[model samples]
Target: MATAPEDGMKHPRTTNERLIDATLDAWQFGGGATISVRSLCASTNIQVSSLYHHFGSLEQLLVSAQEHAIDAAEAWCTRQIGLLADDAMPPAALGALLAGLIDDWCHDERRLAFAWRECHLNAVKQATFIPLAGRWTKLWSGFWAELCERLGIAGHAITTARFFAGESGFHLVPWNRQIDRAALGETCTGWSAWLCGQVSPPSPWRDRARALAGAGLVLPPLRDDVAERIAATAGAIVERSGVAGLTYRAVAVDAGLTLGVVSHKFRTGADLLAAAFDALYRRAATRTADELADLPAMQPEAVSHELAEMVVGEFAGSLGLDELLLACARNPALRPFGGHLRYLRGRTSGHYLAALLGPAKPTHHIDAAIFSSFLIGVTGVYCFVQDREERIAGAEAEIARVIAALTGG
Candidate 1:
């Protein structure tokens, strides 16, 4: 059993018993974002008003959920760290600890996927989770710092903790296929061991993770060959259906996973789509290394050409683009969408400004915004042109025209 600090915290098993039990069952067993209220209601078969007595709204209920998770996580960490006592951090024990958390408690490839997605898309949920996240970060960092000290790695705890967190996720996802729980454990163990051998993961958490796994509290974390599955799922959605088709239920069913599993990772369909987009963008960004490197000295025409390609190749397949645009058009309130516009500007406006201005510095951001707008306009057109050559030629022509106007070229 895990230990909690002497903070008179509610046991997630009792106290606010219904909320805690519901949360634990959901988070650990593949629960959905709306599951907090829905599950509680279903389990108790209570009236909405009665439930509101305890939680004011769905958002409040989620806060309750986050609070429960925070307590559980703190207790979990406390127990693992206590086991280390005065002993030097143990590598194998650390692996088990991480594997257990990732594969079991955090639902590793399960709940974490949900946690990551919600943190991005759900503002209400995001705010609700902040405190829990702080607890998590602090505990993990402390454990890592202790580990680093034992293994002779010198660094500020914050830096080392962030480094470990970044690396820890490398093999956890199923980029190729959706890593399974068992494989996740192995990967966690392998990663912890590897990190321990090299510079070492910030210490107590690492060994404690492994220790927890060994003690049957968590499953071993390892890598799975699921990259292909993840890729295929993403490719199918992009090539055939685009963003609208990337729903949680659809993805879960297609991937032969529980809907809860998908929801746990991604609270809403939008989150799932955004993540898929980001992953694809990152992959394409890697291929644009030379283009990025040469941006500083490239001719205006070359820069324009690169921006055109990104608009067509990277964004053309977003099925939701039209719907998104239409929503903004129909819903007057959405017209002043600062965030959306800012994001578009980041991607395209700077590129356009830079291409039109010259090879000098500071043109990119301005041009990227302009180009991003042009890209949005093209999205609005809903061009169904099937001829690749014609499309390519037209894009080039449009780029030339835009450049001429933008730069007096």
Candidate 2:
């Protein structure tokens, strides 16, 4: 029931203007994966012909909408940064400024909605959205960098900025879940303090000495069998609470092992996460291979439907893959494993493409790549949407459409 902004009482909006507005509104609320020509027409009260006339394809429209959203976010951030510069307070004021900025962002529905959409799309559609995503990153990073510089904080300004922005976004999620506003503000303030080096860094040697003292206490060796059990436990933690929840302590409790045991085996949380993802990727690859082997031979036209069925089956079998991938996307330490996972998915797409298109060509390779990327985006949609059946149906329909378009069927 969203509507386009009115120019004035004197002038009615044009069909193209309405279409653009509706597209942005839909994307802001439901995300890019959910926006369609039909939905745009329905929201804008325009005909299909007009929609096509303004935007030739859904991809083109999505690009336009995303671009518009990015521009708006940039403008807003710029304005906020300008205000911060003019205010010009002491170093201690940084926390208040950040808390205020978060408050402003939380109150602005349009901006909040756009941010949520961008975050979701950035998680799953990185390849297709690289340009826009890069711009958005640069915008926030630049703002944070300037803020840090003004506050006399040194060392890796852009990196610190990006980290602060990411943490702020995380805080926003809990706030939206109806958590107390003061608690969220306090959390953001603490993060801001840490980023500005106001908080003392942990003493590594002290921890190491403590660990050495504990070493005298008899503990079981981290054997291969215990390591595998720890990895399995980490995977289950990821499945239930995502990568952020896969701490060493959590894994120890879940695996029914001592913290020292999990720590001795894994060394770091990233190590534990890497093991979990490796086990998960291997299982998914094996399952997908088995599914493909079982698929009956079919003509090229029917191949698309079969592929759709396979996609749905994969999601049905792996419920937490989407959430884990989102976590991987956000964490830099997990990128290498994430790349491997993507490669496995691409191989599955290539296998399907080979069956449908016969001999592979450069065009077939490109088609397969696009198909793989689209499936990843579909998984992102699956992460947020409530009704699994409806999301699966939509994903199937989208896969069929992509296949038909690729094959000229």
Number of clashing pairs per prediction, in order: 57, 0
**Pairs of residues clashing in candidate 2:** none
lDDT of 2 at 214: 36
Error of 2 at 112 (Å): 5.6
The sequence of per-residue lDDT tens digits that candidate 2 reaches over residues 115-154 is: 4445544444345565655566566667777776777654
The prediction achieving the highest TM-score against the true structure is 2
Candidate 1 lDDT over residue span 317-360, tens digit each: 34333323222222333332212322222343343455445554
What are the lDDT scores of the predictions, listed in order? 0.44, 0.55
TM-score of 1: 0.41
Top lDDT: which candidate number?
A: 2
Off by over 4 Å in 2: 1-10, 85-88, 109-123, 154-156, 171-179, 196-409
- What TM value does model 2 have? 0.46
TM-scores for the candidates: 0.41, 0.46
